[model samples]
Target: MVRIACLILALILPALVAADVADVYDFSDRAQEQRYRNLIAELRCPKCQNQNIADSNAPISKDMRDVVYRMMNDGASNEEIVESLVGRFGEFVRYKPEFDSRTFLLWATPAIAVFGGLLVVAGVVIRSRRSGSESPALSAEEKARVDKMLADQDRPS
Candidate 1:
């Protein structure tokens, strides 16, 4: 009986918690509503590390959601809201970082490394081909020994 009651509580607890957080804000326009949803999904939760603001249940996430709501209601452009949050929290608040001097290495490092690796592989292949095609001539004694071996093999052995 105790185990069954505990299981029921565990199952129902999340639904009750979710109901308390469903504070839906009405938008004056559908476009604004869409914009708000997009912005929340794009912004990262500073406290939650990898989670977006919309998916985090942390208190800081709630505060950020409220800020997004207020900013949208005030007719702020998407860029303005993003810039404001970025200014307050640094670039870490954005899921997709901009291609700037600070982040150039982050975006271009893999491509540069792959290109360098290809150049090394091509160099090695070219050297191997060149060496194989232009092999050193064998000494006359060595040639004679190889010929004798070939003759021996050819004889009905």
Candidate 2:
């Protein structure tokens, strides 16, 4: 009976410990709640670089969500909330960073890479065409030797 009790407790203990407590915030209306949701979804978590604050379970994500809730209650606009977070955490916290001199290269990298690949492909094609067009002609002696080999193959012993 004690062993069975211990087994049950071991199974239930992990489930209790691994359970996440979701954040509960009271917004004035559905619109406010929705706006809060959108803002959190748009903001990337600093600790979990790939996940938005809304989807991340990191402690920093929870703090960020709290700040967003407080700011919304204070009647801050979405842009203002985003700018404040950006100011605090740098542009890395934004999933889609603003277009600027610093980010121009980031945005332009795909195009540059494609153009470079095309140039490499074009060079290969041009070189192949040039090399193929300049095939060396066989000398008279070589042609005669090839003809003799073909004639020998055609003759039965």
**Highest TM-score: which candidate?**
1
Looking at model 1, the pairs that clash are: none
Writing each residue's lDDT as its tens digit, candidate 2 over 39-139 gives: 99999999985999999989999999999999999989999999999999999999898889999999999999999999999999999999999979999
Model 1, range 121-146, lDDT digits (tens) per residue? 99999999998899789999999999
The CA lDDT of each predicted structure is 0.90, 0.95
Give TM-scores for every candidate, taking all chains together and pairing residue i with residue i: 0.81, 0.73
Query: What is the alpha-carbon RMSD of candidate 1 to the true structure?
Result: 5.2
- Residue runs of model 2 more than 4 Å from their true location after superposition: 1-21, 138-157
